[model samples]
Target: MTRVIVAAGGGGDAVAAVMVGAALYGAGEPAVILTYAWDRLLVDPVPGPRGPGDFTGLRPLTPHVLAVPAAAEPVAPAGSTLPRLAAELPHTFALIDPHHGARGIARQVGELVDQLAPESVDLLDVGGDILARGDEPTLKSPLGDALTLAACCRVDAPVRLLVAGPGLDGEIPADVLRDRLGAPVATLAPEHVEALGAVLDWHPSEATAMLAATARGVRGLCEVRGAGLAVPLTDEGPTVHEAGLEEALERNELARAVLDTTGLAEAERHSREICGFSEIDGERRRAARLGARAPAGLDPDAALARLDRFQADARARGITHTTFRRIAEVLGLNGTLRLDLRDLLLARRPEQYEAPLWRVPAEV
Candidate 1:
């Protein structure tokens, strides 16, 4: 079903509106209609040529279009007397306001919706400046009540109140929101603006909620995948390859495996060069022989320590290591460091170890 997102107050309101629009578009929905209300004083006057005989200075304009809508063909405002502009941009839409009070503005928006009856509509009400006085209620308590009532009466589709910034004050409390709205009430994060560029690619429509949920879910998964590859360190260092380090290294085929997955030909060549300099194969063979002779006394912890020392030596020889924390988290590592060593073996470059194992694209 198509849903209407109503953004009430602050900079966060704008962010929420943009996100909601992007989510809908990502779901392959039609363009959304965005309407913002501000105090009359903040509204700029439309400039015109002044006549020599005119006595009054430039008259204050009631409402002005701050931004054109982002749509193929924007619907003109009801009872518009101005000339219609041609649609030249993909995200084009209209900016409109009522010359009267807040109630009058709401009525006008309601009338517009009634006229259009779009499959879905979203009303983003960025709260007016509190310093200014007008017939429209302040965004805190009264405005919230008015909007709730308006949505209940006017819009037949799902209506959501996206409250952010200071406007959230005196409105519904967090605990009460679920009982009151009978739907989800989400908070807007201040950092959302950083992702605006990625977000604009999305188009708003009926399935906006689903798109948002999916994006959030995928990000969570990626984080889980990245966290699984971290090797734990103890006071004595690594605890896995002390006694049979050489044999374990040969059996695991770490070098060959890393070269295969990373897809970095240059890095693979570098690793091979480093391996030759360190004589890793010969060292592993000697360790394996020693391990075989002392098999009865071999300690797993000591073996791990030896592996740690080997890794340190490799690092000292200018060998780079790539850690993939984010990809591990996304892979759902349950605090376990049991990584599939094959991934590292196949990686051609150290950086390839950090790359995501799964091919999920990042969306804001």
Candidate 2:
């Protein structure tokens, strides 16, 4: 039977869901993962999640649900990483349309559960943002996760909440998450990281990259992408914890607030009313301000100098680990240049980098 995993938040959560399934079901089994096509600002630049209409060649699983196969591609001006990820990951990638909000998501998931007949239904969030209380000072992107949690609560099947790399997203602190996460159901090993293969090479998810690095035995403080948030990496980083769904609903003020929402705007309104901000709004502003375009290929010496200055400041702040995405951003590179930065950096100073997050290299 196929393993059904719901990738709770978009971006790296999709990759994390696949890793979670591979750790539990093995890489050979065909798994169907339901996820939003939402991506980082640099990846989509359009802000918010892409729906079924955003892409071409989507096969219908249910009238309300669609499958994102390897052949599927996003129409121009609305970029996506899912289509490329579908081609790379072995599991079947399914799209979650949030335009209609939680009610629509629940209906879509319920129909998918009936069709899959899987051994278990899992809602996997890379970090423990699924359990956000909605008022945490660090919470930036809680609307999507809250909506997913609210929708999963309405699904007919028993959906398990699998939180991997707790606090790695820098949404909620690890100490705050420890009591909330309870005990872990599974600990991802190096083999599970291996299961992801070369996906880490190009994926821009700082949290999921931390998940792979933590599983491979890296530890300590990681300065994540966005706002220089330093998250403490612990032994529990690679473990996937099964949290109480009902209790999660109770803790998530925004999830409960949006449980009955019928539109994305409605849910976002609730998020702003509760948390005082919309993440997509921020993305829109950033995209407008940057109007990002591909720059000339990296000048190794100049890029190395940039890293040296940034790393010195970050090191002063006690951050030892970081992702290539953050490094590229510091160098004023866009989403497309992140991998190029990674490739160039690793080729020059392989000792400074690890699979996901890397330790700052000694100054060039």
Candidate 3:
């Protein structure tokens, strides 16, 4: 029988869940992965989370919850990697609609359990941001994870919250999470990273990329996001920390604030009131500025020259590594060009590049 693994965050968490599932259960175990189709603002310009109406050809699992088939595609102006993931990865990907808030999510989970009858359920978060106190300066997105936490509390099955690659999301620092985590349950090996295969070639999740890199013995300070948070990577980067769902909820103030919320706005309002931050507001503002335009093409020589300068500056700043997203931003390329930039940079300096991140070569 299949196990239920909830992708606590979004795309990256979904990928991490596959790794966790394979480690916990044997490889190729059939699983029903409940996930949100919320791609980053760069990928999907749409301001908040997309509901059932946002996509076409979703297989209805229930009145509220929907299943995204491999053929499913997001409606116009809305883009998602879930369908592509459904096709590439070996798991049934179900869509989580947080439009109706936590209660609705609880109802959806209950319905799913009744239908699928999975052996066990796991709530996976790539980073420990799911345990954010709502006041951390680095906290970016907690609404979705909070919604999952609150809703899982109401689900009939026992849900275990597994945090893989803690603080890799660049939100919570690894040192801060050290005290919060208990004994490590598992460590991702190169084989696990290899299992992900070609998805690493184009997927834009920096944290997940770091996880794979860590498994492959990568270590250094990774500068990520527009904020340029310097995340320290160590050998512990691949270790998975298992924490109680109750304890995690206890640590997260935002999750408690949105437990009774019925609408997405209600939850967002709670977030603003409790955490003093609105992720949707940030997304809306960025969407207005960035629009949906694709990244502009650049001359090969000029691009490499610019990258050479960017690398020198980063090295001077003690930044040993960075993600494609950061490189795209540095080159003034829109988010759409992240993969193209990766391919270009890799083709030029294959030895200095990892799958989804680049390592700055020592001054030579």
TM-score of each: 0.30, 0.96, 0.96
What CA RMSD would you report for each candidate? 27.6, 1.7, 1.6
- Candidate 2 lDDT over 199-312, as tens digits, reads 888878888989988899988788866777787778888999989999999999999999998899999899889999988888888877777544556788899888999999
Worst 10 residues of 2 by lDDT: 289-298
What are the lDDT scores of the predictions, listed in order?
A: 0.28, 0.85, 0.84
Decide which is better by TM-score, 1 or 3: 3
Q: What does the lDDT come to for candidate 1?
A: 0.28
Sorting all predicted structures by TM-score, with the top scorer first, yields 3, 2, 1
Candidate 3 lDDT tens digits, 1-364:
9899898888888888877777778667888889988887767878887888888989987777788989998998898888888889888889888988899888888888888787988888987898778899878888899999999987888888888998898888878888888889999878777667688888878889898888788899998877577887888899998877888889899898888878999999999998887788988888877765654886778889998998888888898888888888888786557767777878888998765578988882
Off by over 4 Å in 1: 1-6, 10-14, 24-28, 37-93, 96-98, 123-172, 185-195, 198-364
* Among all candidates shown, the one with the greatest lDDT: 2
RMSD of 1: 27.6
Candidate 1: tens digits of C-alpha lDDT, residues 1-364: 2333333321223334554454333323334333332211111111111111121111221232233322222122111111111132223223333222233334434554555465655544322111111122221222222222232233344333332221122222223322222222333222322234433222111112122222333111211111122211111110000111122123222222332222223323333443332222333454455445522332334433543453454345433332232322222221122233223323423332222122222210
The predicted structure with the larger lDDT, 1 or 3, is 3
